[model samples]
Target: MTRSLPALMLGAALVGLSAPAALAQSAPMEMHAMTAAPALNLSAYGEVKVAPDMATITFGVMTEAPTAQAAMADNARRMQEVFAALGRAGIADRDIQTSGLNLSPQYDYVQNEPPKLRGYQASNRVTVNIMDLTKVGTTADAVVSAGVNQIDGIAFGLKDPKAAEDQARVLAVRALQDKARLYAQALGVELGAVRTLNEGGGYQPPQPMPMYAARMQMAESDSTPVAAGQLAVRIDITGTYDLGR
Candidate 1:
């Protein structure tokens, strides 16, 4: 005997398969309705001024000689002296880092001719982190006295900025929430849950201070003038809030 499905049973099976796709289409519509819900966008910025507690200075010794080996040797000797001076200034070995070391041949360009080899130049740059702001001037003096002929520049920063930045972020979010609530009240609508929160800004890294050619030299009585101005730690945030009926 041949057996076939009844018309009503076959129709029910087809409907069951298509029910999932119908739900899929309605799912997007539901999400679209949620996205289109009335909402308020708020942005707030917060900044806190804090005096720098630490300073970083980059300075080095540059030497020139007829041979690369000679130049390198002279540079090494001067750097060793500078390292000793830095150690005496209460800088830890971990805080002193060799930022750069290079040996390049000096070239002299002639009119319409190939460059001539003048001499070999070697440079060793060291970066020192001073935890005490009061030692900024004295440290610079010490390094210069120990034969740091080239100075890149100095930058002032905080040793730990996480706490300050966290406070700023909290303030920014609070300000944003306050604003959102005030707007909602004025518009005669209840404030609903937050739809989205975005961090628009945060603390900026330290920047190199201005370079002074005259400050690099000392006559054994002069100390480098280092002024660590207050750095601003800023935070900005944006929040989207849904409107309740």
Candidate 2:
């Protein structure tokens, strides 16, 4: 049956109005379906302790004289001797690096008086990497005996950190998983697959040990007693896990 023109127009208007009303009624259900699922977020860390295999010692020679030229010359001569001593101690040239060199004028300070020029001082510093742990003590002594008057500090570390870091990473993941499981059980929810995983914190160097000129007390035949204590390698991880009934 053919509809009249006015009836057709009226029907088209009614259909347009009903379409929007139908969409409005379904919007809430669509939004509910799009809601995010329940999830648990957690962070954990792990550590592994192992003995250090290598050491680096930063030591220097300080020389003072009436003139800057004289002070620098004296410093250079003493530093040469120190280098030779290190060579004797089995430290290769590749391991030795000059860290710093400076020349400065010294001042004699007196109460209520202008500063007076005392002399000029020159200093040279070198950092040496010792691969052999047993030679650390004797190496320190050798440098001191050969003209290293000032010992700055000593640091111990691993030659290669990959293995240790990998071990730490495994431990960290296990810890994170265990924590997620525990939380899920306590909440009476089943633990689901990990939604996201993140990793952080690896291989931090140990703090330098404090060393002083006074501590290098030389015995007739004994080397300085250096204790290579254990070092801790750590790893941290964060993970998000899905939670379900």
Candidate 3:
């Protein structure tokens, strides 16, 4: 049997009323789910100072002669002597690297006259890693005496920077946590667990220090003096911490 028109109308009205009630009941729950907890975002850095255990020195032999072949031959011979000196100074073949070798024509420029060819100049540059700090000065002296006329630069560094980087990472995390705590205390809130963490910076090698070739040419009785200063390893970190209470 079919329901009466009035009963059907009543049922439809009841259904409409229940739909709004259900939506109203669930609205607060949906809003609560969508709301995120308060977060404190912070960034911090850490640094560690350490003495360098090794050094890299770039030096070369420059030769000038009337002919290109003569200039190159002279440069090669002097480079050989420099290599021998390095070997005697306890530098391994693996530590020695040829950075550059160039031969160029020299010219004399005169006013109201075209450039005149003077001679050919050749240069052979080598970069050597000295593991022993004590031998740095002696090695320089030996190479200079053997045939190194150009001293490009010197850079000091660690044999292994992993330990230093890890130490800096620890310090960075501690600093971040401290900052979060301080912020939380200031806001009169409790610090919660770390929501996210990101790491950025790491160990960066220092730039090579300039050294004059004349200064490297000390007296025969005295070796070249080299000072390996301290190096700073740094770490940067950013974190997101939850706030509670």
* Best-matching candidate per TM-score: 2
Clashing pairs in 3: none
Off by over 4 Å in 2: 1-27
Q: Model 1, 120: alpha-carbon shift in Å? A: 1.0
- After superposition of all CA atoms, the RMSD between model 3 and the true structure is 4.1
TM-score of 2: 0.87
**Candidate 2 structure quality by residue, lDDT tens digits, 1-245:** 36588898999999999999999999999999999999999999989998999999998999999999999999999998999999999999999999999999999999999999999999999999999999998999999999998888899999999899999999999999999999999999999999999999999777678786666886758888888989999999999999995
In candidate 3, stretches whose alpha carbon ends up further than 4 angstroms from where it belongs are 1-35
Please give, for residues 1-245, the per-residue lDDT of candidate 1 as tens digits.
13555777888999999999999989988997777778899899778888889988988899999999999999999899999999999999999999999999999999999999999999999988889989988888888889988888889988888888988898888899899989999999999999999986666758777558687576667677777879899998888899986
C-alpha RMSD for every candidate: 4.3, 3.6, 4.1
Structure candidate 2, residue pairs in collision? none
Q: For every model shown, what is its TM-score relative to the native structure?
A: 0.82, 0.87, 0.84
Model 2 CA lDDT for position 33: 100
| Candidate 3 lDDT tens digits, 110-139 | 999999999999999999999999999899
C-alpha displacement of 54 in model 3, angstroms? 0.5
The window of 10 residues in a row where model 3 has the poorest summed lDDT is 210-219
Best-first order by lDDT:
2, 3, 1
Cα lDDT of candidate 3 equals 0.92
